[model samples]
Target chain A: MSGAGEGPGHGLGGRPTTGARTRSIAEAAWAAAGRDGERNGHGRTRLQWLMARFGRGTVIGIPYIWLLLFFLLPFLIVLKISFAEFRIGLPPYTPLLEWIEGGYLQIKLAFGNFLFLLDDPLYVVAYLNSLKVALVSTLIALLIGYPMAYAIARASPTWRAVYLLLVILPFWTSFLIRVYAWIGILKNNGLINNALISLGLIDSPLPLLNTEVSLYIGIVYSYLPFMVLPLYATLEKMDIALIEAAADLGCRPFKAFLTVTLPLSMPGIVAGSMLVFIPAVGEFVIPDLLGGAGTLMIGKVLWSEFFNNRDWPVASAVAIAMLIFLVIPIVVFQYYQHKHAERAEES
Target chain B: MTDTLVQGTHSASSRPEGSRPGAVLRRAEARPIIEIQDVVKTFGDFVAVDQVSLTIREGELFALLGGSGCGKTTLLRMLAGFERPTAGRILIGGQDMTQVPPYDRPVNMMFQSYALFPHMSVEANVAFGLRQDSLPKAEIRDRVRQMLDLVQLGPFAKRKPHHLSGGQRQRVALARSLAKHPKVLLLDEPLAALDKKLREQTQLELVGIQERVGTTFVVVTHDQEEAMTMADRVAIMDSGRIIQVDTPHALYEYPNTRYVAEFFGTVNMFQGQLIEDEPDHILIRSDALANPVYVGHGISARGGATVWVALRPEKLAISRVQPDSPHNWDQGIVEDIVYLGGISTYHIRLDSGALARVTTQNLERMAEPDITWDDRVFVSWRHDNTVVVTG
Candidate 1:
């Protein structure tokens, strides 16, 4: 096909127009042709045919629309609610915008919700405990996942698939059911305590469940796959020659691993940590089910504030504060991702 | 003190008197820096390296040249302590190194992909081995700087491997490997990753570095030209065994077997039988030629035994008329003429239904020959030019 009338300089009928106007006019013409294909006698035009089916904008707009609807919209709603006052009403929160007398608009935003969160020492302790649990669990997951990921990555192709599948196999079960199963394994009369008591390794049933230790175990077990998969991805793609080169340069095998393998897989480490830590910071179900009374986590606090105390505005404020707390790790994760992409492009 | 240290550690141990490039071939008594005794490496049921024994002299740039999967790389890995031989022992500087790990051994390797640490700067990469040795920080810095300067990568000391070009990254890998001044340096396909022009340039630069550092280098390459251009002595391997090991000149001029003759360069093999067996001369009767091929040398073969004569394309002459020598000349019709810029090759189909290739140097301005396709020509070679292989 000749591209005579397709470029920016030319319009139909040898007319001159600006590029944007030309584009709009062309789009209209294409739309008209699409509506009545036999009018032009050459069937539908290429632009009309293609754009009417699927264009670049529609392809790229799909994910944007998804994020806008599901993520940004919900986040804006939460932000708006966080500014409202708590009230004993149907929705249980005062509206930020309201119609007033004298035909004047009244906008009442209560900053007291945020101030109240700062005033309550219980909320502060819960935030700190949440961070502590998330940080400790993430470190534990990394410690356990790195070696497992390394083993899977170094395995043969056939065994590699099997090992990766094994890592993901736990996900096939219901998440809540798996956490409940951990309760059965960690409780005072559960599997470990019974085995230890029968083996004469302990005198009595240990207070294993409903404690901080059990909470750590539950979080680490659930998020360990998240850590291992990304680590495996990076480790599998890494050049094995680098390790060999390190060893050949008079570096011991373990030292080679510490120098080469660990540093190179930093991107995967950051990514996996962010994935586990972000959801973990606001994790609700695990702490609600497995945490003891002393385990004051922000998730449990947020849940009780919204449900038991019926304080939606305060819970929303706590959520917003938790987000502000997590922005640093998210930014760190994004920075590593950007650096990794830049290095990939360079090589 | 520095002078004594430099000489005492590296060149003093490796480089003997008169042990330069060409001179090393004559020094038969030069100390062997690496000795592989009956080394056999197997992966499961498949034997990667058979019972092979090799001795590499100190300060020699040796090449293990072969095609892919020919066990050249496997042998190099065994030398680097990455793979333990299933059965034999390796010695470096007359010490048993078979049971020793790579870090414990005094050897370094430059990977084919260069394998420069993407995270580390050029300086840090070169200093990696030195740091492992727990050298003083000041000494490590000085040696790193010296190594970078040696590879002409001083300006790129702060740059990461990904930030540099392929050639520059290769230089970084070289510098890193050479910084340790190990007893041996193994290079796995060092020039295989570069473009043709850069590969030729790097080949000479590598030889220069090897000589200046005075370290024994064992390089593995599938490219014959790379091996010939860079190696002081090349061991051509095939199918888990070394076919032959000799100087580049000798390997090219006098190949021992048919595989060696064909593998090193282009050759036209004629199936024949030994007709005359004499102390001074031997003659071959061939079905591929109307004439008997004469060699001005004796062979340890009986009469009427089957033999093959290998002649390089450049060694054979093409002419429109027959020469005075009737024993070594044959008449053939030109099937094709390949006019390369520097030289031209003529594919000649002999009357005996055998095809032969003859290359002539295009020395003159009008070197485009008058001889075209279907033109009859005579192909002749001197008796000494023929390489006879019993295998």
Candidate 2:
């Protein structure tokens, strides 16, 4: 690995034309090597320095490329396939990247399915329902969960731990289990129905199951913890002095809460709602299990298009459409977070 | 004229004739705006405020000064109706306000953290209390504007807490607290968050504002300098009891306890016994030095009572040679010297292990450095300069 094995006169460090100059160059290189610390630099070479320059690429660049490949690439593929026409018994058809004689293909494409979606009312309704359901569920969850979060925040330290545990415990168990458990209370012959009938509250089972009410309950149940955690984080960090300060400023308890506590808790509410709403928009299972076959949702529609109708192109198109619906809000939320971080820095 | 008005309305035929409105009004006329009458607040077994009592004048800027956990904040909270006294009552404007909740109390508190509402506009935060009282919309707006203007925050009304600077946010909190027009304003470490220079300026401004508003102010602070500069009367607390309550100058000149003398500021304390009592002056023989110290006050207490005499650093004269003025003479070797600008402090180690710190103002550039580290020096204070502590 060394120029030493070869003549000292014949290497990159040497003046190749003359032996004495080469020897002098070798001696200088050796002195530089000797100046190194206890960790030996004797065997170091130009190749290691060159490799170190590109070393960070292996760490940061690989994950970046990998995410682009597995995550971004799949999304783009869905977008590409979405523009293709769907046919019965055919996988989603696309003209993207057809092989050429040079063993290469077309690299870029356009949005025909997006045009088809815009022209159709059902697709538009799906987008609207998703937005409607997600927003409604998030609002309901926040309204119910803030008090619980506040109670948790103000509770004794031991009780706070217990309450927070109860809030998050549902999340630790399988999401499916919680959804199914809701069905037991919601079904016609299930807990609520049976209890009501047995107690002579109703002669017949009410049409409570397989309704938007049931779907709403399921959505709220699934996302309530999301709202509570963020709200708790904000509420717990709140200075009790702030409440006292407000009260001292002539506010009654209710007014103090309205002015100080509620306003300060808005960031938590916004953050929590964003988290709950975004995922709930794409929710397939909860609505499916509780919504019955008549449920008209974007996720359900996409699921049916893929499995029931065997329209792969439309399924991919639905996935892309879902993404298009999501992108703006995500960007907005991330921008808010970044701004908050900056404000935190300034303060 | 005020006394006749009260007596005319009272029932003179009541059981004890003189104990009626006549006496009550007479007492009320001279009484302070606030009185903590044997107010004791105990949390479990820890007495946060132990039977403390003090009077605050109608427009006095009073300070409760102490170190952390010294019950200053607790006392302030009790006064503000945030904490209930365990065994005694607090009177505000001659009304017993012990059971009153913080929201209902006439007093308003500016919290230590400057707790401005994060979500509201600065104007909205200020308007909150007025709105709570169900004031008319126009009146609420007017008062909010007035408060903001008072705090010089009228232009920044729409700015949120995060958008404003620390000082601006602090002003918003100040505005909000003042908007209520409280009977008395309680400030808990009001300028603690500001930088040193800003704190000093704000302290002066706070005193001016309190005076202008004509509201009594009770400020709780751990910083001795803040308490001294801001308070008309300072109550020094230690271990949940008020050690001494007096004007800053009085407390410095006539400390009632060794703890109060040391806690208020830096002092060179000598453990001593009373040697003689005089009408104009008293002499105290100290174990730390060869001579006795003469203080301004006369002490008549007996021979064996352990006592202390305190000397402020600036009052003590330091010289490398023997003192030419003989009556107030003492000696020590300079253990350490710190050359602070405008004044240099000499920490002189005595025959006793205690180090007596003496500061001399660097008044002249022509004067040679009198004492340096390890230089044996004579330090003395005038008879009138020394303060006595008999605790």
Candidate 3:
């Protein structure tokens, strides 16, 4: 009541003071009603109101709980296996906990698997090779996808949708089938050599299959859509006036593209690179099918350790090491994303 | 260098009393910087700018004013070298520029969207054009600083365009476009994105900057008020053609056609027949008025010709008592009164069944209007206020 008397209408006249008094009286009645309701144990209405107010929380909880159950739970299980010793048993690994003598529980932990990974040179070489292959493949995809994305982005509106659909048209087929088709084209007497020979340009078949080049071709072809889609999205949304402004500033077309268009599409480039690099690092199918026996990647090493060598503990440890190797690039990607988000918020 | 045909020649009757006459006087003697010789642009079959010829003098703030789809923007684009004319040629600084690309042309354009590079900071955006010329690093830095200071955005030099306000971003765009000191600067609806109050302020600031720099500026705008406020000379465009070219005062006071009068501002129009045409004076007989309207000046038209009489709303005086004048006064009943704080506009319905708008300043601090709705009133104008147009 005192606060109401000291409000904006304090010095005016009788009419405003009387209006403020009536408002204060009404506010007091509302407070008394709330207290009365709480004391009478009428909690059902209050609970219903709380639920109505916080319904968005319930909607957000669905995906949160899903990630906990599906992703985090499986990861923890693998982590537990990575700590146990290997043995010929039902689960093919030693138990983390057991009941020893006198009905006392004993816990056993092993660091031998992690130690073995560091001791062996094959693991070191495999990790480096996987990094090299993923980096090379990501670069190849970017070089090929950027122009395609730019062309599609600059196309007419009706043609833009058509070109985008054509880029993703390869995805409707099975991944395994697509990889298999690459084998036929990259064989010794495959399409390239056959065409050259028929055109009288080649006298002998070329060794096109089972090489690093073939592996790169396969990886790039498989992940080209992932690279092109993000690039197109950013390029299409860019204002065409920025290019004009650059030209009006006395920049030639190519220089304008380098200074204006390229820098503006960097977010898409980073996003596409991350999307292709992370999966290509652990890619097993393309390396096994096209890389033949020479190419060594961590995914193949992990596969052989789990199946051929039957070292489940060592395989789990290798998986954990591979995850650690990926964390560095993911962190860099996160930093760029955070910077972009801040810039967006400021605007 | 010497184009006698493009020189500005006018009489006192054309240029009104209140506009910036000094700008007109200064621009009338300056040499023409840009000559657009019957340029035509067509997008497939639809013509955007059709055989439009214009001349912009050096150190003049010229505006191409028109409504949307009226070829004003297309003409500006052609001047900026972004759009090549389908016919004819353009000359900038006495050089043929029709074949020159936008990059090679000595002109810069400030886009309506302010299209500042989002990836660069304000300092870098202003330095971008200088860098393209491969100027010394120290010179580029100094010029960028100088441009920023000119726009009063020196404190925000390090900020990116996204972090700046709309007005700040607008200033940065202006600075970047002017950093190169191009022979001509083109602006496309520069203040359309700003709010009304800020727009008015920026308009004056832009004029001040133009005067300080003394660079030839060609601004394209659909807003008549902005053109009138900022431009030294304005060209009205419509349907891919130039309608009339004159100073703001001349364009308003002595419009050559009905379209120019209606497009520039609000006016009450009367369809009348020229009863008498003389060297000193003329008479118009309008069915919307009870008596024939007498004009103080004669026009180049025959007697008994169909003409339009355009009377501005502000020029008419409204009162309850009948005025002494019989020819220019009309009796009407006030149908509506729009109170606009400083002035009141009365919508009157005349006995001839025509609607007329009369605006008057509120001279007294009265609680209620003395001339309310449904009150019979007389609205009259001076003989010199009549603008007779044949088209």
- List chain B TM-scores, each candidate: 0.93, 0.88, 0.93
Model 1 misplaced regions, further than 4 Å: A1-54, B1-25, B324-326
Instruction: For model 3, report DockQ.
Output: 0.65
Clashes of 3: 0
lDDT of 3 by residue, B362-388 (tens): 888866677898999989999999899
Per-model CA lDDT versus the true structure = 0.86, 0.78, 0.87
Candidate closest to the true structure, highest lDDT: 3
Return the TM-score for candidate 1, rounded to 2 decimals: 0.89
lDDT of 1 at B114: 88
Give the per-residue lDDT digits (tens) of candidate 1, residues B1-391.
1343344335423543332545655645679999999989999999989888999998888999998999999999988888999999999999999989888888999999988888899899999999999999999999999998787778888888878988888889999999999889999999888999988877777776777888999999999888877777889998899899887777888899999988998999998999999999999999999999999999989999999999999999988988887699899999998989898899999999999999988889965577889999999999999989898
Model 3: what TM-score? 0.88
Rank list by DockQ:
1, 3, 2
lDDT value for candidate 3? 0.87
Shift in Å, residue A54, candidate 3: 5.0
Clashes of 2: 0
Model 2 lDDT at residue B291: 76
For candidate 2, list the clashing residue pairs, or say none.
none
> Over the stretch A1-347, how does candidate 2's per-residue lDDT look in tens digits?
12233223243344344456546555554444445642226455432332344434554666787899899989887777776666544454656667878787755454666676778888889888989999999999999999999999999999999999999888778999989998889888999999999999999998877899999999999889999999999999999988887766666788678767897787788889888999999999988998765667899888988899776777788888798788888888888879777867866
Encode model 3's per-residue lDDT on A129-171: one tens digit a residue: 9999999999999999999999999999999999999999998
Q: Under CAPRI classification, how is model 3 graded?
A: medium
- Per-residue lDDT for B144-205 in model 2, tens only? 88887677777899887878877777778777888888888888898899999877767766
